[model samples]
Target: MAETDREIKDSLVRAGRPDRVEGRHVNMPVELGSTMVFDTLAAFEAARAERYRSGTLYYNRYGNAASFKLETALATLEGASAVTLTSSGVAAITLTLMALTAPGTHLLVADNVYGNTRAFCDGVLAGQNVEVEYFDPMIGGRISALFRPNTAAIMFEAPGSGTFEVCDAPAIAEACRAHGVTSVFDGTWATPVFCRPLSLGVDVLVYSASKYISGHSDCMLGVVACSDADLAMRIRKHVMAVGDKTGGQEVMLVLRGLRTLDVRMKAIDAAGRRIADWFAGQPQVKRLLHPAFESCPGHEFWKRDYSGAAGLFGVIFHPCADDDVRAFVDALRHFGIGVSWGGYESLVLPVRPVRTAQRWDEPGPLIRFNIGLEDTQSLIDDLDAALPLMNTGLEA
Candidate 1:
């Protein structure tokens, strides 16, 4: 009998299940150890020889059973031939770029990528003699104009970080394919539940598992998924060589979090869209930077390429005094001020969009919000109470 396709939630729940276990434990046991003992010398030699070739598990640094289980689950989720777990999301990005690029390699990066990503490219990759050119996220199919004969790759983010400008990923990826250049995408925002970059012709898909995959704010982890087996091998080899490995317990947390990712993502999406729509109706909001809205740049591409939205979005306040902006955010009781999001608690952060290849002309401050599992009406009431702070110009 042919197996039928299951829904994402069902697949996630069933993923990484051991075929047979003695104790019948629902989750994979956390195997924590740096060394693996072998009975015979020949077995040790064979494992060492196959380390880079077959991804043999010889040492914990290379990865343990728990890490492999999580990697397998993530690979399945992202529709990738293989996946590599890393210490952090930034490490995933760095490792993928380092594996694919060489000195003098030319990279075309989206201008609106995460600030840390830009810093790494400009500071580290630049020192390595890698040439990086930032391009407008809305360039779409026209990005071919920026490609050079020596262009090695293109890095992009859908519904870009902070600003929420959706890029034309498929069109840009098609151009990269035609030119024989590698395509890398930051899939942290949408995750595989909402968008699959591999299906869109992207060769490498990177994620900050610490945000959505871990669900809780406790763990810090990242995973890089590759569609090509050879590319995956290269990434794995590089990760092993660089000693960039994730702990066994962190992998277990991410694996556990995967089971509930679908439900959490959907719930947060509904709440975020409701708040964004409500914000649009407010006169104090200059603009709503959400991919689902037509006002956002390249939103049509988002609607066409993405199956769903995440909880993160940005809002531009009407031109006002800095004190008013500060008062509004300071007055919020439900939304905690924080740097990262995707946890159980809602968070809000003030952001200054920094762009060189593009222009940001908003006259007011911008705030990025991460709607959590809180009740929708309760969050709305919190915002309602805070909004008066801006209207009254009160520091209270």
Candidate 2:
């Protein structure tokens, strides 16, 4: 007799349980609480002592069982000694930077990293008297030359924002080790499924769980995973102090997303490469910026280090009027205009990429693309119709 769909799903779910849970299944019940109650004064004192020594939670502000399980799962994926959950990705970045760097320390950042990350370093960290230095996204091992004695940490985002230049993460990690600086990678692009930052010698790994981890664009959460005992303690303490905690439902949603992560990512990865290859052949597209493609910056590094690529990539079109370019995007029937990537639905955003550090300017206007779970033929048709429209003569 054949098994029912529900029974098959249950069995499939059992097969993908996180190893660190010690025989526990992927479905963990949420534990909601404001304040935990103790029956005896001795027990209360014991709890207080535990809270002081280990930063254990007596209230939801610190954490609950749902959040704790999420942290444990993330830590297991990152190969870190521990992980701390935050309300959002920026919260993780803010709290981690606040805990790791002193007011007078220096920070080096990738030029094409997420705009808000650069904003945080400049507006928040630099405002506190910390020196902020921007480096080319393709700096790789050459990053060592810019390190100063007061440099506290280095941040990286692989296949960086807009242009999708894959950095030499291992080389950067080595440079960080030589300078005795903490290395943090925004692993939201690859997540733990494709890249393990700790395995490559990065000190800390951060994620914006709102993207792929939740898979539905519903919840916003962040996770910081690290192997250093001291750094883990610092992040936990900082998160608790600021009350940057995710709720039980969000925690459960992320957990549910994790169960099908392998399946979802496999589809996205395969479909993305197909669509990217098709875009490369279009005459209107001057260049395709995808780490998996040979023409991409740091392609060799991505081939060597990363096991797989995500659904996001960038494209440069032949010089055209703004309206023409907008019409090209508007012509697409499948892809939607959106701010964030990493959802089940495809998206496209036009960008005017400029050179800040070096001469890596685009021949034409730039646009970022996120390939979704749509059929490859449908996405190809949408792009085919859109690319020709971009080359039309414009009335000034």
Best by lDDT: 1
Per-residue lDDT of candidate 1, residues 260-359 (tens digit): 9988998999999999998898778878999888888888888888877899999988777778778989999999998878898999998998898988
Show how many residue pairs clash in every candidate, following the order shown.
0, 0
TM-score of each: 0.95, 0.90
* Tens-digit lDDT string for candidate 2 (272-374): 9998898777767778889999889899988987878889899877788788888888999999999887878999998655445666656578899988888
In candidate 2 the C-alpha lDDT for residue 159 amounts to 77
Q: Each candidate's lDDT (Cα)?
A: 0.85, 0.79
Top candidate (TM-score): 1
lDDT of 2: 0.79
286, model 2: CA deviation in Å?
Answer: 0.7
The runs of at least 3 residues in candidate 2 whose Cα sits more than 4 Å from the true structure, single-residue gaps closed, are: 1-26, 52-57, 392-396
